[model samples]
Target: MLEIIGVGVALIIAVFLVLAARQPDVCHIARSIFVAAPPERVFPLVDDLRAMNEWNPFAKQPSVRNVYSGPERGVGAADDFSGDAGSGSGRIEIVESIEPAKVALALRMDRPMKCSNRVEFTIAPQNGGSLVTWDMKGRQPFIGKLFSLVMKPEKMVGGAFERGLADLKTLVETAREEAAQ
Candidate 1:
């Protein structure tokens, strides 16, 4: 009986390993929102690393500590942040920046998962407002692949991205209205 049970457990583990290995090497997810504000008003929020703190929904934890480095805005701009286990620690650097159009970021996540990802935000003029899209692409680690088998990474992270975009829309639109007065 014991031998049979051991063999069953081994089989399960082997299957999990195989599934993880079969998982895709690259992971990409994107979310977009329409903000009732122009590109000029939306560009600085993402271009200036420090200004990001105002609407960055992910690192809102009270324990998160952030240290900025390199240029304050545009390419080479970066920030390193550390916090509780959930928030973890990571570094984000702007690798590409085009005024009122796009900003690409290099993200290195160290604690929860050790991986490097390319994050980009693109802005497009639409109906007198701006359409902003956030995209994150990375190679999947073995551990991440294993976890992916249980829960998809896209679904897990999509909610945060959606909420962040919504928050950003509200913030910019509200400010635009107030400024018009």
Candidate 2:
């Protein structure tokens, strides 16, 4: 009886491991919003790390003390930040920059889950405003991928992205309104 129970437990463990290993090791999500401001105006805001708190919804205080390297706010520029556990410590390096169009960032985060990802912001001029798209992509370990499946990273993070975009629209639109007035 004891031998039979042991074999059953071992089988269950093996099956669970196999299933976990089969999960996708990569995931990505994107969210976008249109702002009643030109890409040129919005582009500069994204380039400046110090200004992120103004638009980043995930950041509660939105303010962070960071060590910076490279240019003030362009390709090769990087900033290091240590925040709360949920916020984590991380560095974002500007990997690509195309004026008023696209900027790609390499993000490395510590704590919570140690991972690196590619985050990009793209702006398209449209009818005196701009369409902005925020994209994120990362590859995870088998175990990490399995965990995300249960936790739903897209739903968790995507909601924040949506809010951030909405806030950005408000900020930019408000600035435009003030300028016009």
- Residues 32-95 of candidate 2 have per-residue lDDT tens digits of 9989889988998788765755688655544445778889888988888777766778888899
Worst 10 residues of 1 by lDDT: 52-61
Q: Model 1 over residues 1-181: C-alpha lDDT tens digits? A: 9999999999999999998999989989999999989999999988997877777776777888999999999999999999887778999999999999999999999988798999999999999999999899999989989988997888878878888788788888888999999
Clash pairs, candidate 2, are none
How many pairs of residues in model 2 come into backbone collision? 0
Judge candidate 1 at residue 176 and give its lDDT. 91
RMSD of each: 1.2, 2.5
Model 2 quality (TM-score): 0.86
Over 4 Å off, model 1: none
lDDT of 1: 0.90
| lDDT of prediction 2 | 0.84
TM-score of each: 0.95, 0.86
Model 2 stretches with alpha carbons more than 4 Å out: 1-19, 61-65
